[model samples]
Target: MERPRRPSFSELPLRKGDPPYSAWGLYGADDELGTMNLITPAVTRAAVAEVKLGVTIPLDLPLDAIAKPFIPSRVPYEHKLLARGYANDDEIRINTQSTSQWDSLRHFPYQSGYLYYNGVTNADISGAEANDKNGIQNIARKGVATRGVLVDWCRYAKRKGIEVSPFERREITIAEIEEIAEECGLEFREGDLFILRTGLVEKYRELSHEEKCAVAERTGAEAAYIGVECNEVSARWFWTRSFAAVATDTLSFEAWPRKNSEGWTWLLHEVFLAGWGMPIGELWDLERVAEKCEEVGRWSFLVTSQPLIIEGGVASPPNAMAVL
Candidate 1:
């Protein structure tokens, strides 16, 4: 039987700058015809065989850089204690921004309309409790089950004898990612998670405040450990191929001090979260994973990521593992 023609990006009545509703449409007709849900229920039961690769944010980690300033110290001791104790659990703060996290749909809003997922009206996303119930917090709890491909951009750069300083402006293109994958003899598969390691976090931690500021100024973007790029073609490829998620060892999925409209506008976030409803995992610990992959000379592994189940929370620290 002849397959029906796949629709073109322009054919889909999506908002401008919005990522295509079906990434498969970018490849060929029939790409979008496949019946496969990227986020499946099976992921929840997937055995966890790998070590957790998320960073434990220092209790004193500055929240200003990533989020609004935390003012607990300014609050009255009794109220502060009450809030920080999570209603008596002094060990757990009720709202400390300094924690491993993910941004929920409510993190950003478009001037037009639309929350993380398309067709989900803002009215449908109101209220912290309501948003948390249906936001990234819940989606993350389902866990991400798939193979994970680690592309060590730092190692690749080192081999090339090009000292790409994490402190310096670094922007990895999709072509570079593809080349690195090819060099590593890795082949991407459907329902895979691509984790790009750029050695940003290590460098960022070592840099002096002045150095960090200098790097940020030079890049015109905040100092980040890693970021993502698709260059139209790659973006199209990712969408059509059914990747479950894309994460990085950086602060964001894109380069620090982003120069394009995408970051400030949160276009990629919208595309992945709202248009495609895919989750983005950032601030992962990739050094160990990269070293392991290099030692084994293998690039692919089974990846397991399960986020905390906090109803109405926007993001959660991913309990991620990579099993070879």
Candidate 2:
């Protein structure tokens, strides 16, 4: 079937009192119509498709690696019998400490006093039971369904013979991002989940403690790297375009660990989630997918991601896959 022509933002229908930042401005009146602008007809037909081509790397950091100098030796778990016939799995206990998972709306508090994408408030977010009632756990249950495009920044850097720093140290620019997309023969689609690969996870494990700290401190907030882009500008573009989410192989969505700014506050997390009702994925597995694309000389692939449906939980492991 010939695909529908991509619609313009002004063509979409706007919700009553919806903020100006909503993606509807990019397409037309209907939400589905706006979303269709971001996807190819081929991707829409198949709800679950592969987007990550790389081997799944272990996302958890070893407990010993993060042990503090003066902290007492801490055993991750100690089993106690709660029920005679029912035995608990140790993996469940261990998974609680997992840092590699995605965060649900319950995990963060908006400086503006709103909860998450749904505008649930702090009073609403207070109790565990309250959180369970309205949190990312329920919102994410639909599981991110959309087109995913991989922008291989590392490959672009290599083509230029410039060493791209690990995600912790790198700062990609909007222009550089556009360049990578151009080089890869890919175009940004509205409502698409855009994943940028920086090869940071692999390097994080290899760096010495001092080296890692130095890199982290340098990239904290003000530091800029070759591939890192400004979050505010990116957020504005994404919202205007009607993307469902923005993801990356980097630890934090921004350049690295940094102080929260207006852009980071209002745009990155607040506006996207609370205001626009969009989700953001981070610390994704993308290197292998990029490699596959390079090997096949194909920039396009089918992508799918499923997060655990744990009610009231903050984040879930991304069950992501990619097919060429």
What are the RMSD figures for all models against the true structure? 7.5, 6.6
Q: What is the Å distance of residue 112 in model 2 from its true position?
A: 2.6
TM-score of each: 0.68, 0.67
- Residues 253-319, candidate 2: write the lDDT tens digits: 6564433446344435555554444555665667666776788776655556666777666666666
* Backbone clashes (count) for model 1: 15
Tens digits of per-residue lDDT for model 1, 1-324: 333344443454234554345232332322211212443444323423322433221211222332221122222112233454545543333232233345554444444465344444566567443433236555554556666778888888788886766654467888788899889888876567777888776666686777655554443333333456533444565666557777776655666554554433444565565555456666566776677778768777766666676665656666676666
Candidate 2 TM-score to native: 0.67
Candidate 1, residue 311: Cα displacement in angstroms equals 1.2
How far residue 41's Cα lies from its native spot in candidate 2, in Å, is 10
Please state the error at residue 249 of candidate 1 in Å: 0.8
The prediction achieving the highest lDDT against the true structure is: 1
Candidate 2 off by > 4 Å: 1-43, 46-90, 94-99, 128-134, 167-169, 208-228, 257-267
